[model samples]
Target: MHSSVIATQCTGAVISQRERQTDRDKEIVLQIRGHHIAKLDPLGISSADLDDKDPPELLYSHYAFEEADMDRIFKLPSTTFIGGKEKSLSLREILHRLENAYCRHIGVEFMFINSLEQCNWIRQKLESPGITELTNDEKRLILARLTRATGFEAFLARKWSSEKRFGLEGCEILIPAMKQVIDKSTELGVESIVMGMPHRGRLNVLANVCRKPLEQIFTQFAALESADDGSGDVKYHLGTYIERLNRVTNKNIRLAVVANPSHLEAVDPVVQGKTRAEQFYRGDGEGKKVMSIILHGDAAFAGQGIVYETFHLSDLPDYTTHGTIHIVANNQIGFTTDPRHSRSSPYCTAQPLFTTFTRTRLIHVYTPPSHALTVLSLACYHQSRQPHAISFSESLTLGHPVALIVLDEVCSHM
Candidate 1:
């Protein structure tokens, strides 16, 4: 054998080995993706048939590989919880971790983030087992918040059964979800949060989340003469400013829900402008001290033109509020149209967030109310870095007549 021939054979052998390793990595990545689809569609009526059957197995490998193979070949971090703590990697463990992260409650849509750093950060936060677990006290707090939200709506219905109050009926979870965002932002050193939302749940948000005075809100329900010089809008179309201490964070915080008119998405720019001004006044160049939270209706989020226009402002040097937390309270029905008819895109919020060059992270939550609140809190933690959007697409019970009208329209269309 010639020396040159030996060298060529050796090089060929090394190349073959590298190719095998690359093929193995690709297979593992595909398997990880399968974990996301393991469960049936929680909200889909079609999935009711599969409810009794065990969730179909997505991992074909059958957990045959050992721990060493996982660390060397999988490459992804381990988030498997065996005994309430993160454990070492294995083929079986990886499947468990991916299931907990992606399949259980929340389905995070951050693979399109474009930045490897951001993607990995989300994986770590969400993929890590026990990351979404809340303490007993925290769970109790959420329950209390939910109770207040439900009770307020119930009272309003009895008080004004025939009146046109755009109450938060089906999407009562939104109140606790918004509170979670505020609480998490406060923990991250945010002193002021400027929020904007449509009329669907403005009064509930005003009463519970903003902690507006009960007397002031009750007075608005009256049909008396205008207290202000100008003609007043509907109660739900109103906004309030409250500066109070966040008892949870023990920090003084300012909460302002910007008033929006019947034009559902017109307040988006106003919220951004308010957030940007606060950042400027406080010299929060990085938007650490001030942030914005914009809430949108599912139909308006996709159908409205201003939602896209406001997103374009996020990356502008002068107009950017560093990052804004967008929460879409998707009841799956528009003012008069169903989501299937109104939204061409899969997610109403996804298109607007990704249409611009801005790096926006979206989390599509399909969890129960309690788990939904916890997942929302995790989503808010990433907002200060860049714009983040969370869509809570859970089915809500619509008790109001207007929501019933929307539902009737949906059923008729069906």
Candidate 2:
């Protein structure tokens, strides 16, 4: 009689354990499904546009559901799972956190990430909770740069009403972001960065970030001749090479802003060639010390054939400058032409950098001057010192052109 009763008790305990596990498995499945359905664009759409309203088709069936048993709970997430670390919150709460972190104002398009290892590393960094924080000093530095950029432009508008400074009104944040990029790279032991950009916002970047003197800029407007040999095309197109000490990185960075022709994006390859020459002069056998940075307007980046030609050159074994950073100062409208007429791609960052070349990272972020450094650190933190690409949002104006800041770092093999 005693043996029979003991057997009955054991059977009941097994059934009870199975029922509890079944409920937990159902809950975890729902959360995982929610993660994949998260929104990822800054132009936040209404709830009605949500096509992912229904659960994924696979989760409806018997096999896929049963396969996700309680045994898998203690293990890492599988190929279909879309979560990071285990959390204590309810299923809805966890999904909300995941969406906010990965799919906020900064929309990162990493579908073209080439290596499986790199893709995983980048996803982990971007999805982590601590990715958003920055030190206090970093914030102050960004603010100072923003103030200088805006202050200089405001002064110019008042002082020289007739002169077309091509001011950085919408994209004042570019200055501070560049400041942070240089500082961050300097911290990582990069010695120099060669930058190229269009005439738009040229004056502001020159004066505020490049440390060009205001008096010289004013003098050029007063006495400059027609843009002839392109040596220093009219004052706005004039180029400068200088160095600044970065307190945050405790390193000095040498920067050269190359003069660009009015013909948009004509200087893309020119800057690369110059950067390679500089690397050779410095005896950077591996092209690791010097980085080439080029800024582009959104229209030029996508529509121009020259941009593709320039990208192809980087693929050649002889022509790689380790890596180059490409920033598209994307103000939505490229010149007077609307985006509908100019670009065939959906988002500005959705380009062929990874598909054609296979060695780039493309990230998009909405950056006002206030959030410049914080956004920059988050973009750079995951990449570890490797070359990749990133795009920053310009505060758009209806009548004025919108600039998209595209940053691409060319990768070098050791």
User: RMSD per prediction, one decimal?
Assistant: 11.4, 12.9
User: Which candidate should be chosen as best, given TM-score against the real structure?
Assistant: 1
Q: lDDT by residue for model 1 over 375-411, one digit each (tens)?
A: 1211110001111122222232222334445565499
lDDT of 2 by residue, 165-194 (tens): 676665677788788777767877789888
For model 1, the stretches where C-alpha displacement exceeds 4 angstroms are: 1-42, 45-87, 225-231, 352-356, 367-414
**What lDDT does candidate 1 reach at residue 114?**
61
Candidate 1: pairs in clash:
none
User: What clash count does candidate 2 reach?
Assistant: 23
> How much lDDT does candidate 1 score?
0.60
